[model samples]
Each structure stands twice: as structure tokens, then as C-alpha cells.
Target: MTWTIAGSLAVVPAPTRTDLLAEPVAKALAALADPDAVGVAEIDPSLADTAAFCEAYGSPLEASANCVVVAGKRAGEVRFAAALVLATTRADVNGVIKRRLDVRKASFAPMDEAVSLTGMEYGGITPVGLPAEWPILLDRRVAEAPELVIGSGIRGSKLLISGAALAALPGAEVIEDLAR
Candidate 1:
């Protein structure tokens, strides 16, 4: 089947789990997806960020999901989580998430820390192959999208899969009001 994103981006068979450059993305797919249903496409490095990617690729913001790393501290120990929300919304780091984590405060993880911890690039940190210890929080809407586009753990590519495939990832938790 030919998979295209918003009628512009051509999505071909995703790289296999053994593909070194996309190891994390591959690992995630191996663990959570039906290999035949996943698709991937390369994009310009300059369009790696969400807005640029959506606009340049003819994908609507509503069809894109952003994965953000969040950090919180309680009892002198830092805890991390991955929050998935549609590009049209923002994660509720200060309110809902902070309360959910039971931390005094919760904030976006530092860029360097997010990249280092995920072993992914700054603009391509995806919830897919995140550390098993961290919770993968998905906004209700994100969990319901028929299909969506997300990072491939590298700036040069994007992963296209059904929302159900994403929610099935290990440790994914669907929550209402996760984004606003």
C-alpha cells in the first residue's frame, strides 16, 4: 500500500529494527507496531521542527503530534516522563502533569538532558523508544487520531502510524486534559 502524508509526503516501508541509524525508532516499532502498517519518509533537516514540517510538507497541524520530555523533582530525586500532545495544543506541565507526578513542580526537560537521555536528537525526541521507567502520557485526542505523524528519533525522517499503535507502546497512559 502506498502511504502518503497529507497527499504530499511519500511514505515508504519504515526502516527495519536492525537499521542502525534509526535503532530507537526501529526498536519501538518492533515492540509496539505491526511492521506492515508502519511507514516512514525522509524530510529536509531544516523542517525537522513541527511547524516547519507541517507547513512545508502540507500536513495539517492537527495531524501531527509532538513528544515532549518533562522532568519533576520530589524528595530530592528527579523523575522524568514523556508527554504526547497534538501540535495544536500544549502539554499541561505546570498543572495536570505536576499533580499527576505528585511533584512540587514539573517543567520541560533541558534540551541537552532530553537528547542525552533518549539517545535521540534535540528536534527528534520521540516517545516511542523512551526509557522504560518513564511514563508515556498521551493526550486523549492524540490517542484517538486515526493516523498521525511523529519524529523518527532523527531529524531526517518521520514515522507515520495509527494512533492505536502509539497508544500500544509500552508504558503509554491515556489521560484527558493532558494538553491544553
Candidate 2:
């Protein structure tokens, strides 16, 4: 969607814009506002799911944001882990993530745990469907895109949302180089 400001000075289109496809992203948007705002787009039922999805929608693979969930120990005793990284950058498994989670080592959450906990497929565990307490670490670069293609809490399809909107999700924190 486009937000325009019309005043005595001049009319200007907002720097950020978001659209609600009749898919995964729409639902996500609703959740973000009152219910949610993320939506999922049903892509070709092929092995190369995301690639196929991109081809169908004329979206580029590089333009997609990858979100991953990690679980590990935090602090000397307290345990915590769960992060979202962009497809462009690697998760700072040894830096901020390690320091933020306060763990010497961190790894991807087990597939079963990821699926069971988030109710999203292995290739589609978005921050939206993650456990309510899960901390969402978003990369700043992801927001640079006019919009981003992301998961809609599912794998059968992909969803699109404004990067800014995704950042606005409750509990989501913006970090630069959150990944390696």
C-alpha cells in the first residue's frame, strides 16, 4: 500500500510502501496491526519452491529475506536463542548472536523443534509463526528494499510485506550485521 502526505507545502509519497497480496502476506499484515500483517503466497508446487515462487511472481531470489530460528544457551546460566537473518548476510553465530544470547555456541533449531514450535515448514519458519516469546532479530539491510518477499508462516507459498512493517512487529529488534 502507498501512503501519501498532502499538505500546504507539497504532496509526497512516503518513503515506505506495503502491499497486501491475497496470500500469506495479507494475514501477516492483519496480525501486525490487530490480528496480523504477514501473508503467504502460494507458489508452484515444485521442488525448487522459492525459485519457482519468484519466477511466477517476477521476484528475484536476491530480493528475498531469509529468517531462521536458533535455540541455544544464553548468559552463564540463562538459556535463550532465536534469530532472523537476511538471505544476504549470515547469522552472527559467533558475534552479536553469541553475545546477545550470551552463549558461546549457537546452532539452528532442530527441524522438528522448528516446525513443532512455529507450525511452519522447515523452509518457512517466519517470525510471525514463531513462539510468542521468540526474539526476532531483523537485519537492517532487509529494510532497504522498497518491499521484501518473506515467509507467511508456511512453506507452500511465499508472502510479501514492507520491510518497515515487518520491523514494526511487536518485539522485533533492528540490528546491523546481526549476521556474519
TM for every model, in the order presented, reads 0.93, 0.72
Question: Model 2: residues >4 Å from true position, as ranges?
Answer: 1-29, 34-39, 47-52, 55-57, 75-81
Q: In order, what lDDT does every prediction score?
A: 0.84, 0.58
Scored against the true structure, residue 26 in model 2 reaches a CA lDDT of: 40
CA lDDT, candidate 2, residue 160: 57
C-alpha root-mean-square deviation, each candidate = 1.8, 8.0
Q: Residue by residue across 1-180, what tens digits does model 1's lDDT show?
A: 554455578777675423423567677677554765877777887898999999898988888999999999999999999999999999999998998888999999999999889988888888878999999999999999988888888898888877788888889999999999
Clashes of 1: 0
Scored by lDDT, model 1 comes in at 0.84
How far off is residue 53 in model 2, in Å? Answer: 4.0
| Candidate 1 to native Cα RMSD, angstroms | 1.8
